[model samples]
Target: MELQKTILKDCFILKPNVFKDERGLFYETYNQNVFEKTTGLKVDFVQDNQSVSSKGTLRGLHFQNGEMAQAKLVRVVRGSVMDVVIDIRKNSETFGKSFSIVLDDVEHLQLFVPRGFAHGFITLSQQSIFSYKCDNYYDKASESGIIYNDATLGLDWHLPEEEFIISEKDLELPTFEEAVS
Candidate 1:
């Protein structure tokens, strides 16, 4: 496994060395030693979550506060998606900045988002099956989110506006300025 750092501190893109043959293919999706060696952080994933979304569906810009903050290992297993992560840590230099990548079954790549960021994705295929491992469990009281289309963040989702779809909860999420103030 090879871990490449993103613009945001501690965020990473992990590419597994896949071996293919006439029969099939094999790869180590997660190896603790390599993960720790590359990122220099020990994460013990406690929960696994999976979701399926149709093309144009957007799910987040979500995170938790305090002890419920989570670090996520995210990947798309069935189709493709435009995965995004935003730096929300008030104390960090990159606060309010965002990073994005296209994750698909063909690449089999995974994204590691540290605890202090907001995470989300938009499906780009007919249907996308997304899975992730989280270092912390879900805590409703600690849950928070930023609006996906917040002007200040200025994320280019690369999807047609007419096709974009978001839930009422997501649409009601606070903006970066709203959250800070």
Candidate 2:
């Protein structure tokens, strides 16, 4: 596997070395020793989660605050998605900045999203299975997020507005400025 750094601080894109034969294909998704060696950060992912969504389904721009903040290792298990993250660390130079990438099963790419960021994704295929490992357990009171269409952030979903299928809860999230305040 190879680690590629993103513009955001402490974030990375991991490209697995896939071996394909006439029979099938294989690759190591995660190895603690190799991860520690490549990224120089030893993280213990305590929870694993997966979600299945259809095309145009958008989730997130979400995160946990304070001590409940989580660092996520996210990837597409089946199909594809346009994954996005925003750095919200007040002290970091990249704070409030966003980064996006197309993650698909074919590429077998994984994104390491550090704590102090908000994350979300839009399914780009007919059906998508999104999987992730979180370093921290979830706390309802600590949950927070920014609205996906906040004018300040100016995020381009790359799909027509009418095509989006967002939950009422997510549509009611605070704006980028409100979230960090």
Tell me the lDDT of model 1 at 53.
97
CA deviation > 4 Å runs, candidate 2: none
Candidate 2 lDDT over 65-141, as tens digits, reads 99999999999999999999999999999999999999999999999999999999999899999999999999999
TM, every model? 0.96, 0.98
**Tens digit of lDDT per residue, candidate 1, span 1-181?**
7778899987889998899999988887778888888778899999999999999999998999999999999998899999999988889988878899999999999999999999999999999999999999999999999998888888888798789889999999998888655
Candidate 2 to truth, TM: 0.98
- The parts of candidate 1 lying over 4 Å away from their true place are none
Among all windows of ten consecutive residues in candidate 2, which has the lowest summed lDDT? 152-161
The lDDT values for all models are 0.91, 0.95
